[model samples]
Target: MLKEFREFISRGNVIDLAVGIIIGAAFTGIVNSLVNDVLMPPLGFIMGGIDFSSYFINLSGGDYASLKAAQDAGATTINYGLFVNAVIKFFIVSVSVFILVKQVNRLHRREQAKPSAPPAQEVLLREIRDLLRDGAPPRVIPAADSRTV
Candidate 1:
């Protein structure tokens, strides 16, 4: 059972999945940063300085100046700003993944679409086989003549 487990873990698919998971975790951090640090400030400014993280409903019926204050006061609140940030993060990550997949697919298609020349040996062998099957040597025709004489 231990050997089987080891073998399963050593498999290409398992290793690939592990790497993908690690990369995805790191990518999530980058997406979060992009949303929080880069995208949100300008967007918030454009929206009359409304911080999405501060947009919350106080369920405890307490007037709080900010989400941090509400949380510090132990008030139950629906934090919609955090949700908006999360949505933005998700969108950025999805777009990046989509672009990556699209480029990878395009490269795969290009590789598949390229026509490969047959090996010289194979071409030579085919010509010899055809000559033998037809019981004739290759006849060279003059460029001026259209008819096979």
Candidate 2:
């Protein structure tokens, strides 16, 4: 059982999956930063400086300054701003993954497009066999045709 478990862990697929998971976690942090720090500020400014994080509908009838304040005051609120932010993050991550997959696929295609080297010994053997069969020695052809006397 221990040997089986070790084999399972040592498989290429398992290692690849582990690496992918780690990379995905790191990429999620980058995407979150892009959305929160880079994209949101300009977007908020363009939308008349309305902070999307604070956009919420208060179900319980108490005036709250922000979503955090409402939550602190034990008020039930529909936090749509957070939902929007999450949706934006999802799109950013999805697009990034799509581009990464596309580039990988393109690289794979380029590798496939390259011509492979011919087997030198096999080619030489084939030429020798053909020469023996035809009862003629292999000779190089001249650029211009020459009449043999």
Candidate 3:
């Protein structure tokens, strides 16, 4: 059982998957920051300076200035702005992953496009075959006159 576990941990695929998961977690943090801090601000400004982070409807009878205020006052609210932000984040991450995969595929295709070297033995055999095919025909001597006069 211990040996099996060790083998599983030692496998290249498992190690690669672990590394990928760690990198993906880090990438997610960056994408989330980009969405929340950088992208959303400009997007909100372009939409008539409306702050998307605060765009929500208070379910309770009383009105609140922001989602936090509504939540603090124990009011049920539909946080549509947060949902929109999440959707935008999803699109950003999806597009980035798509581009990365496309580039990797392009690189893979380029690697495959290179021609392989021919085998030395095969090359030599082909040369010999070509020589035989293009060689002059053999002349036949007469049966009675063996020597050339």
Candidate 4:
């Protein structure tokens, strides 16, 4: 069982998955920072300093100045501002991934589009086909034993 487990862990797919997971985790942190720190601040400034995260519906019938204040008071709240931030983050990540996948797919298409040399048998057959199309006399291809039909 240990040997089987070792073999599974040693596979390239497992290593690639591990690396991908780590990178994804790091990317999520960066996206979160970008959304919360970089984007929201400028947006808040434009909107007269009303932070999006503070746009919440307090269900506890308590008028709180901010989402944090309400939450600190243990109020039941619908945190729509935080939801908006999350939506923005999701959009950014999804678009980035879509662009990456699109580029990779384009590269694959380019590789597939490139014509490769035909096999020797196909080359010979093409020659024969071209000759026949040019109205040349049909000649039998000689076999391995030098016999022609």
Model 2 scores a C-alpha lDDT of 0.93
In angstroms, how far off is 33's CA in candidate 1? 1.1
Reference-based TM-score of each model: 0.77, 0.76, 0.78, 0.81
Error of 2 at 100 (Å): 0.5
Q: Stretches of candidate 2 above 4 Å error? A: 116-149
For model 3, residues 41-94, the per-residue Cα lDDT tens digits are 898899888778798988788978778989999998899998998899899989
lDDT by candidate, in order shown: 0.92, 0.93, 0.89, 0.94
- Candidate 1 lDDT at 100 equals 99
**lDDT for each residue of candidate 4 in 96-125, tens digit (9 for 90 to 100):** 999999999999999999999999999999
The TM-score obtained by model 1 is 0.77
lDDT of 3: 0.89
Highest-TM-score candidate = 4
- Clashing pairs counted in every model: 1, 0, 0, 0
Query: What lDDT is reached at residue 2 by model 4?
Result: 100
C-alpha root-mean-square deviation, each candidate = 9.0, 9.4, 7.6, 4.2
**Error of model 4, residue 33, in angstroms:** 1.5
